[model samples]
Target chain A: MRQRISAVVIGASWGGLDAYSRVLGKLPANLPVPVLVVQHQHPSGGDKLPWILDTRTAMHVVAPMEKEPIEAGCVYVAPPGYHMLVDVDHTVCYSLAAPVNYSRPSIDELFFSAGHVYGPGLLGVILTGANDDGAAGITYIKQRGGITMAQSPVTAEARTMPEAAIATGCIDQIHDLDDIGTVISELVFGLGA
Target chain B: MKMPESVTDEQVSIEDIEIRLLLEAIYQLYGYDFRCYSKASLRRRVLHRLGMSGMPSIMAMTERVLRDQQFFVTLLNDLTVNVTEMFRDPEFYRAFREEVIPVLKTFPFIKIWHAGCATGEEIYSMAIMLEEEGLYDRAMLYATDIDKNVLAAAKKGIYSYAAVKQYSENYRRAGGKTSLADYYTAKYDGVIMDQRLKRNIVFADHDLATDQVFGEMNVIVCRNVLIYFDRDLQQRVFRLFRDSLDMGGYLCLGTKESLRFSACEEHFEPVVADMRIFRKRQLMKRETR
Candidate 1:
């Protein structure tokens, strides 16, 4: 049997807002897998993302606080200016220790921490972006026996990030942006395919 | 640090081994302790420096670290990047002006401690606030950090002139009584903060992980510093902050940080929840925050 995914990490940049809306909007409510996302965003605009995504998805969407308990069926957005990482007891932790790869809530930081936390039950997806932030991170997820995937470069609003992830030679599948969320719901909750 | 119960020496990879050894070497040679820092973040910083140095391994980097004092200083910049801005998260400052300063004004004399006050952005910001509120003459601000280099920089109070625009905006939003421009004069390529603010400020080298209780204070603001430390170190600092604070003194943390899960939670109650400002409570049973 395919190991059920327990957590999902999504990363994107450049054209992420509309693309995030698409992926998050299409997901079912009972997405047993916890979803965490890191999108390169300006620190000043920290207020609106979770609110915007909440309208798109049935899942409980939030920009979690320091040491907040991470639970299933919720989407946590990494707040701008602070990085979101997982702790030993599975709490959501925030960090201010400078930016990685020029992004504060770096995709690599989230993916690496998720791999450490969920291990074999992790699924990391690299969506549209203009840079290669998540490529090596997905590679690391693959190393930890977690599933790795990339949004189809052709379907992505900007292909650089997804293409970079595919170039890692660790991606298990490449699916269209619209279908990726359905695939995840199918894998985790047996809802959509 | 990684939990000892879950990881063995063998489970930690060679890269991790190199990192541990490097940290050990740095400690043994320099007496600067970073061993208690968060493992993942420490790993990232070491790897970044390792790559920048173009060394094949962290072991090699450690070798260079021992041989060259200058290289170590360069590594220090990478490791302790004090990347902060003035009046960051303007809401917190607005909160300070409206909610905190009023309570502080009641005191005849005020002592403020800005622990882990990286590059002194917030200290200057605090000084300006006190000056506006007519409390500057009576307040003494102790600014401290682990890195002596950053402490020296904090003392200089100079910043890139370009940053003034954003700082001005934040100052206005933070309820500044006077223009933000009033606090600094333009230098060659930067702006030097008004030297008058430095009169009551003391910049010192202090480590949260390995330092003693420095003083009794009415407010202890250690924002964004606890996030770097592990659980044990965080608790240690909380205890330090708790003991050092006067009864009913304020404790301000980074907007994202909390004492809710910490050992020190029982000693503090939220002054304003949204602003992350807490007041020291009398020793009592753990009630709700």
Candidate 2:
């Protein structure tokens, strides 16, 4: 079934840069949806993730300036030291609110907010992570009728997050790292070319 | 199979009810407003407090929060997380000192508000910057926080000596004109801020979530505080700051916070966009027709 995915939310931590490079690498230059990502890193090193990802991906990658628009075909990384949420108004909102699950830019905050706002139009991907941060978020996505995907635990560098997400019984698919991006493209643009 | 119509889904949970009632109880009993905080963060904190308090659930926790004065203070501390640092983002200070201070030089006097200034690190930083720039004598800083405990510490102008090492690094990076050691003296485990820094500062209790804007000012430095608020409250605070700041006054937000979706965005122009510093537009007064 080809349900339109208006936005994609990706959550990763611990081994995220490699996971992001792999996934974002496969995305086409003109994919027609906004992609928001949360990759937990040190409180001071936000510039590195987007800088690194921009080289590996076709899409425009940025750690957006405050109040920057959320545009399609652009990849937005959650800046360090803040929790980022996709507003119901379709703009990205950042918060310095206390950490959730000991993470400033917690995967749950991004996924849950995007899930609530985008609802069935959202697709959430939980990537390699050390902690169980994205579990409740994927559940929220499911409750909102959004599609959820997890990198197959067997293929993940840190399988805890994927396994936890799968435990929620909300993931629509558990995919190999190589196939996850392809699955997203097929879901968003469909298989027929 | 269809779901039961009588059963309400995730939109309304038992915890949600408990949280609502808890917030209401706190407001009615203690007059501290948590009603407009970002919901998820509030819930997380309340649940954390619940776990720490060894209460069975939020309902039980709410009862204790309302009745126990000491416990309420703990809950208040949990709600307002003042994880702040001196020269937290050194770039912000550098931008303000380089760009904004030049414009302020045109004025005879300057009034600055350190809104939600957790432990006054920002207040001290600003004081030092202004003093070095030859502007502190003409500047008055109003430092405020919702949590009185933090405000008390801020008033003392002392921080752990261990932490001063990082602060020194931050001071230099923030374009400090003189050595940071000139401003503070070490006393055993903690360092006492120079008394001159407090000469022009007024520390007060101002709750952005509930209180009214006090005095008009030339510049307002409210950094990471807005991140704790939901959109509605954020807008309310923006409007308050807009009203509090004189036309052409400066407003510096958290580096990560933006005015893109703010209701008051039009009233200000970006001074340093990437640093989240904005200037209120100098609107022309209209002649009556």
Candidate 3:
């Protein structure tokens, strides 16, 4: 039986821009669920990721305002120097707390919050990166009965992130970078047989 | 594949309930309201305190928190977000100098409130900017925080020398006219901010959660502080800011925060939208017949 997915969370670090363009760029403009992305970046980094991703993806990408409502089809990217968490009330909240895994917008923080809130209605995706930030998050998502996916190690620009996530034995699918969008679309829209 | 019945589901719900009760206990015993704080972050902080205390659970921690004043104070420190740095978002400072300063020049005197001024890094940063702009003598800066401990630190105006290097870089990027080193004298392993900067500054305890407005100001900078609050509390604070600002006063929030959904959204217009600088709208003139 297929469970209804409410939100899709994608986490990446090193080489995330290219990976994001490949995966998120393919997601349809009329997606039924919100996509939250946490890409590790410098603390002083400006809010340019959303604008860059907005140019690539069909979905509307934005650096969400504090306590902004989670809207369908919109892609919310975590701002630098802050941890983005999903509140139980379906709003995005930013945290100035200590960085986890040396990352302010840690994937683990977002995943833990979203998994706890969305439970089985979340789809957690781990993409190309050089760290193990998203591994624990994927484990939590899986434990919460959410679907988890990872980019195949060979296809990833930096395989450590996906490899680490794959090592957790929690991921439901391992797809090539190019095929991730299609799989996500299928999982979200139930487009496949 | 069929999923197993999750035991953690029950555990999660139970933890959440315990947390709610714990917050309620804190509020009832002491007036520091953590009830309206964003729960995800609040829970993380509470659990962190619980872990450090080596308590069994939040319930057990709450028992100690209610009985012990010192323990509760430690918990309050954990609950309040105190992470701040000098010129943290340099672009915001740059924008303030460009857009807000020109208008501020028109006023004979300026009153600026630094709400939640943790450790006073940004307050001193502002003082330096004002000093460079030749507005320091005419400016009265109020630095306030809920935690007295950080406020005391803010008053001391001494920061580690290691952090000062990054602060210098941030100062430069923030369009500093002179070297950041000029503002502080080096002490033993630390730098003490210029005493003159503190002359016009007043450090005090002000809780946005329950405190009333004290003064109308030319600018109110409460950055990154509102993110911890829930919707209702945020709205209340927004109204407080709106009422606290004189007509045409500038309001600067954190880079990522917005006034879009607030009740006072229409009360101010964006001066630098990217930097989150806003100006309170002037009152409508009565028609002259």
Sorted into a CAPRI-style docking class, model 3 comes out as: medium
> What ranges in model 2 sit over 4 Å off?
A1-7, A28-34, A46-48, A51-74, A86-93, A97-102, A111-123, A129-148, A153-172, A187-193, B1-8, B11-17, B51-56, B285-289
Error of 3 at A123 (Å): 0.8
Model 2 chain B: which ten-residue window has the lowest total lDDT?
B1-10
Give stretches of model 3 more than 4 Å off.
A191-193, B1-10, B51-54, B283-289
Quick one: RMSD of model 1? 4.5
User: What DockQ does each candidate score versus the true complex, computed on alpha carbons?
Assistant: 0.33, 0.31, 0.54
lDDT (10s digit) by residue, model 2, range B12-77: 366678988999998999887888876656666676688677889888888888779898888888
**Pairs with steric clashes in candidate 3:** none
Least accurate stretch of 10 residues (summed lDDT) in model 1 chain A?
Answer: A184-193
Q: Could you tell me which residue pairs clash in candidate 2?
A: none
- Best candidate, DockQ-wise? 3
- Candidates by lDDT, descending order: 3, 2, 1
Q: How high is the TM-score of chain A in each model?
A: 0.95, 0.96, 0.97
TM-score of 3: 0.94
Docking category for candidate 1?
acceptable
lDDT of 3 by residue, A40-84 (tens): 999777779999999998998877888789999999999888999
> Candidate order by TM-score, highest to lowest?
3, 1, 2
Off by over 4 Å in 1: A1-4, A26-30, A87-89, A116-120, A143-145, A189-193, B1-12, B285-289
